[model samples]
Target: MCLRGKQRAGRVQSRVHVDTVDPLSAVSDGVYRLDREWRFTYVNAAAAALLARRVEDMVGQRALDCFPEVAGTVIEAEYRAVFADGRDRVFTYFHAPQGRWFEIRAFADPDGLTAFIRDVDDHHRSDQRRADRVAQLTAVLEALPQATVLLDGDGRIVSANRRWTETGEVIRDAGLRPGVIGDSYLEVLSQHLTAEDRRIIGAGIGGLVTGGPRAADPPFVHDYAHAMGSQRAYFRLQAARVEPSGQVVVTHTDITERVRDQQALAWRAAHDDLTELPNRARLLELVGEALGRDPGRGALLLLGLDGFKAVNDSLGHEVGDELLRQVGARLREQVRPCDVVGRLGGDQFLVLARGCDAAEAAALAFRLRTALTRPFCAEGIPVPLTASIGVAAAQPGGDGVHQLLSDADTAAAAAKGAGRDQVHVFSPGLREAARWRLEVANRLRDGAVDELVVHYQPLVRVDTGEPEGVEALLRWQHPERGLLSPAAFLSVAEETGQLIPITRWLLGETTRQAAEWAAGGLPLRMSVNISARHFSAETLVHDVRVALHDSGLAPENLVLELTETSVAEDPTRAEDQLSLLQNSGVVVAIDDFGTGWSSLAQLLALPIGTLKIDRSLLTAAARLAAGGSGSVLTAIVSLARTIGIRSVAEGVETPAHLQMVREAGCELAQGYLLARPMPAADVPRWASRVRAAGGDSCALALRGRAH
Candidate 1:
């Protein structure tokens, strides 16, 4: 018994040393020695600090004295429990004097009871802080934007965020009440509780509950949506299995607004702002869709304006703007209710029809063509317009919309080639041709970087058929595509505005070559065709002067050929440009005459010095299909005579045609009958033929000579 008592005493001493020597003791409670009477006791630094008194004075005082207010009840309980119950007691006591809280433990013994007290203030305060932080975090989770769901062990939802409940109300007319969380996941998303999403979410609860899809596990997120018509709402949902815990906590984030904005952005990107029409991108998409469907049931048409530039240039853009609006109206009228009419960028439009065969599509295109040809009155000006439409019927095959649109585009180009206001169907070959055109166009833009050259066709005097001048015609010596005629690529040049540079080159080169000839005492004239685009170019006048100065060729010896359409394109502007050239001493000759609307009156009004009759009309002169057909020639010839303009008969092939043309009082002739368009080196020899043909003395006057 004595040995055990000594061991207990040593253990007590060690615990006492540990408590007092510990540096945290100053911040802790104290150990106290109590008397048998429970009246006065010893105090430690922490105990004195808690009681708001000195330890020396505190000792010998009753435990209740230091904490009089709380001691009456709290302190007395610890004392009574240890003494009356004959048991150790432990309780929390708040001392008003220091306004601090502590835990007091008392033990009973023969001498009295020793007690250990711990302040426990910081610990309690720290616990309260942690609780506050958790509460704050909970509040934030409640306020998050995504709809969330919590589930119990049975796969029944247990809770949800406010966004979830609110979105439910928007999705349905009634609110998804708070109890909705306890519902099955499938029931919440779909009318059926066994939906796939429910199965997925349930399985997700099954595996790594807080991060993946498995049974009894919660995924990090549950992102899902239900569609209403064309609109769909999305949410991020999270659930945790917390297995034996049996409760799953879910969170939500709503992404409907973002989805809506993305959709709107996509739609706006492919739509035209002005007409709200499907733009090029959307049109291409439509073509794709059409092609993807049964080919025999769908068709597409690509329509492009023919000579619309003339109207836009002459009447101004405001009127042109109105014209476009009217065109849109007409197109809308022309298409069926189910058909789509989209503007595929400037002056290019596309039409798509379902259940229409190739022939019907062609008819539709022709209808549009007819309507467009009808004159329009905008800003008091009669504007005539037409469109070349390319028709492509869907073939039963695997093809993309972009490819089908390209085929349509190729067909449209072919239509334009056939003659404006016409329609052409697509063939497999057209795709390759279109590709070839792209390559050719690129080369043409580089100024024949791949071999663009010009050959001159001689114009001679009538009667004597003397050499008058030569017309410079561009020929593409494409490296791989082989030699190509102007008809094959000139339209591309004009369309891309490459004609300006090409015309400038032709003028300068022809001038230089002609000047060299003159230096060689040839003294021959040279004529270069000027596209309407070139005439409108700002540098046109400068180009003419530069050519003359660079080539040292006399301005009068250089004639500019203006096509009838180009001259009539903007007659006022045409006359203005002609006046500029004439004032610069450059002669102007109207080319491809009589076909355009500008009559003899209009032709005479322009400041032109020469007129080249159309080869078609001259071919008619050669045929003499009848007597009156011959009369038409006499009238045109007499008109040129009366206007005092020099007339050149084009396409004078046969001797009979040449004799007929000379008999018709034609002033000059240019065709194979004299010599075909030839190279510069061949011209000297050809000039020898002209001299032998007596072209030098063929006097040309707009008089009644032989008609």
Candidate 2:
């Protein structure tokens, strides 16, 4: 059988040879033969069906006529080239009329061309979608802010953004090969990164690439520091796999600013703003760390500046601040090389001495105290300062940081109590005392004023032996313990700010009891001790007025007794308040006169109606009476007499005391010999009994002094 076509010259041409039944008819692909005239000479059954035409009708038809959409297209050009060159050509073409893609293979023969055609629409569309996705991914990668690179499953860079290019240039100068397309990202990183960083990065990215069944794995992230010349730069690397494609996208973001900000915040949190020393929180942490290593090897020195409050009050706070700074500097310089000096807030400093025992700590504390006592010049003036130092050697099996601080603080309190410019080592007794103080302060703060009761001690005239006034003393009836004297808790109250309320309560109670006594024909003047804190509060006058008004007691029947030290604390304020009270007919007496550092001039300048000589002076005067050297007591009493101010001799416990005050012309005296401090209910009966006994209790006690 033969296939023939008409040439342009109108002559018959043999295109292909075929079997009688056309063996190409069973092939799945469409097979056809065309002549040089571009006419179809033979079409198999598949070709006829693919062209949607009958083979008998299409056999002699021209291809352009059957499918004119192929004209002026690459399919037509390739077909013509195959014919001219006599070469075989394979190409894919879209037939617009059928809206389908087909792959065509044309073989040029001497006479004509035989073509094989297969439907390839699915393959073409799939390839087009993949190309579009790659283009979109490239666009997204270019738009990223951080340096980014895309890696194929083989760990080779497939694409990178502009930022990655810039970063690569920097890395190239650091003796590393920059990552480019087809380069391994890990290989480039391994050049400059540490071994650990390389291991971490490799594991992270590798896991994502070959994750297989674990395709939902979280993205890998790491932070690293890189040396860029003289300075350092920090970066966070993040890598995530592209799903279904097994490709990984890696990003390097700079985090240097964030890291530096965090560091600054941490520093400020731990350091003091004024002195740049470790604050309380940081000091506790340091102590804890030291104790963690060797709990019994170290010691803590707590130094509190003595008379700091006086300096702050007398001079301006500016000068005081300068003094504190100097003190901190001195402490820092005085400590050992291994010691850490830190500020524990205002006017207090702490020294951490490593590997020191109690003896060594005490020695260091003495040195610190010596250094602190030296005069500091503030604002071109020499200001004297001193410190009370406490030494607490770290003990094994203790409560650690807080316990150490507490022990040191207790020791410091003991030193201050002993005297300024002193050092005290911690002891178990101090701990017990500290616990008692804490209990007292806590109870006082928790409304313990109700447990307070007043006891009255008579102040009698040394000349007439008649009762003149009663001094009110405070006593605490503890729930657990027995009645407590003011000596046990008054100092703690003053330190804890519980003194003012206690004083106010005392005033009301004493005034009310005095009014009751006066109503019962015993009209004794009430004397209540006032604190310096009251002068500072400026509510002393108002509190006194309220007490007197509430109790219906005459102002003349109330006496306010203040220690000379309390008055000297703020002399101007004390004078102002005391002058007003004196004008109101309330007697103002300076209690504990000789015990304070106040000069006689300051004492005499105040509007004092009476001076209660301190017990120590009376004891000294009695000891020196036989030697005719009791001039100090006689001088004080004579001065009071000349100034028209009454005198009361305190601690008149012996007949000698009573005789001395009487010969010294003391106006009044009170002691255990005459009558001890009694309850409020016992005061009226006692006063009446003293009045019935010839109104001379002092003389009666003197006459019966031997018993």
Candidate 3:
């Protein structure tokens, strides 16, 4: 390492002025300061913290008093050497009280001397791992034909391989020396370097030179030439920035050949083996990144081939692949480079556009829609496919990756919701709703006991309409704003892993309530909605059983509701767990049916006795009945009947809604049209209303619906 032209003669040796500030104070790597009397003058935060003593208490404390055993031996010699040399010294020592080994950082100071100690007992393997990684990097760098060198911030050569030396290059500076005492990198550079190189190196000399703030995500690359190597070599510098030290340690690798390898690897990783465009992984990564960051008033659109499934089903995947390629090319050409274009596995694709005013995002979406609409002749057939695009945008600091993707997904569902070949941009109301949802998520993570509460909505038989079960719904009675529904908190619950404890709490309380109900002759079934994140663990089931057992209730009385996506993530585990519950006499229901990824085939195969038609569909069915069109209601009713699984409509809010259920042929309608979730103490009284006229049941349902 060397620096060339700088004069050191007149430069004040500030490094020697330790003053009242202990030398250890400047050394973060575990340092200690000793006085003239061989007593401790200072200890760095690291050393003080490690020794479990305050810096104030350690200062002026005699060595023997601090550690009686180190009186005249290794510790004494260690302190003396630092004072004598006036330079840094390293040594290893066993610290019995700490029960560990240490690598000490020692140097002389104005007061006397200072030392930094690090507990390296557990670092042997870590050091080896680092060494092995460095060796691997060296091998990789050496194989490249391009010259490479890693330059320290001081403009000294930190690492230079054979390729770097072979290239004709060097830096000359003012003063020069080899193994010179008190010499610095400036000494070497001053001896040999060009004028231009000197200016480039000296650009930051008068300013505080530190790496910029840490990048949230890493694997960033910096491209430049190694001053030691005159050849135009593209070196990729990977830096690990340690904020506390204000230092960025960079590893240089010759990337001329490696870039080709990188492209090859990227192609392999992000392209389909059969049809190479962008794989699901690449699409998700790009989309996830786009979605994750503050897109700054940008829009995200998820475009799916409207009739892709039909294409694959009718024609072979080969024809489908060709069709996909043509479609991909058109989509690629449809957007500007500023927008991210990616294929999200199968026929799913996404576009992320920044600075694209809403109108522009809409315009781009239309172009993509038109490009996709073109008919492609495949497998002796003209296969026509359109797209359903869902668009969502960030509002100020409103959107992160999760929310954007979700909104896009929801918007896409809206496009699909409104027939395909259309694009749907998320409405302001939806974004506001999402914002509220995020608020709930934050509350869930912070252990917001204030807002947390559980409400139970009663479930009844279809014909008898008797309250047979109670579905627990979580409500956040926010202080600033009134009560909020699970829709606000559920997504947050799923995201922050609060769902587990929340589910556990819900299960435990439901068990207690159910036991009380049974004891009081109500004996209603206790049902709880399950989140996808929770099913991965056996703990939830164990918790349910514990709650049941603790509450003196039978496991047979518990009913767990799972939406399609929840089961899809881990169907085998779900099946096994649901079997455990069902075999114990409990019931399992697939909630929010007709709204998720799974099909009727999976639905029938699943171990469930009930299916809750999504509220949108049920509401649509009910609306049709209210409008005197019995046709749609009748058909939905027929579908439910044909499936053999009991159909439950979740948002029945009126008498007409209930009547529609009876007319449509669905079994149960739970809503504000039914009894709302009530306190456990009020349940027995409410349960008495089975024969208490439909209005009583209706009142409770409205309360739940209101929530």
Which candidate should be chosen as best, given lDDT against the real structure? Answer: 2
**TM-scores vs. true structure, each candidate:** 0.69, 0.81, 0.45
On residues 1-707, what C-alpha lDDT tens digit does candidate 2 reach at each position?
Answer: 23334333322322332335567877999999898998887778787777787665566678898878778998889999998899999999888878888999999988699999998899998878766766677789889999998888888888899999998898777655788999888887777677898899888888887776675367889998767656677889999888767788888998999988988999999988777888889998888888888878899999998989889888989999888788888888988888888889988899899888889999999888877667899999899888888999988788788888999999998999997788999998999999999999999999999999999999998878889889999999999998999999999999999999899889988899999889978889999999999999999999999999999999999999999999987899999999999999999999987898988888899999999998998988877877876567888899988888999999989887887888888889889988899999998788777777788897677667765
lDDT of 3 at 27: 53
What lDDT does each candidate get?
0.73, 0.86, 0.68
Q: Put down candidate 3 lDDT per residue, 605-650, tens digits, no spaces.
A: 7778777877777777656666887657567557656766777878
lDDT of 1 by residue, 264-298 (tens): 99888988765667888887777666655655477
As for TM-score, the candidate ahead, 1 or 3, is: 1
> Can you tell me which runs of candidate 2 are displaced by over 4 Å?
1-134, 174-177, 191-196, 309-325, 377-382, 628-630
Model 1, position 262, has a per-residue lDDT of 76
Worst 10 residues of 1 by lDDT: 698-707
Off by over 4 Å in 3: 1-439, 537-540, 568-573, 618-644, 663-667, 689-707
| Top-down TM-score ranking | 2, 1, 3
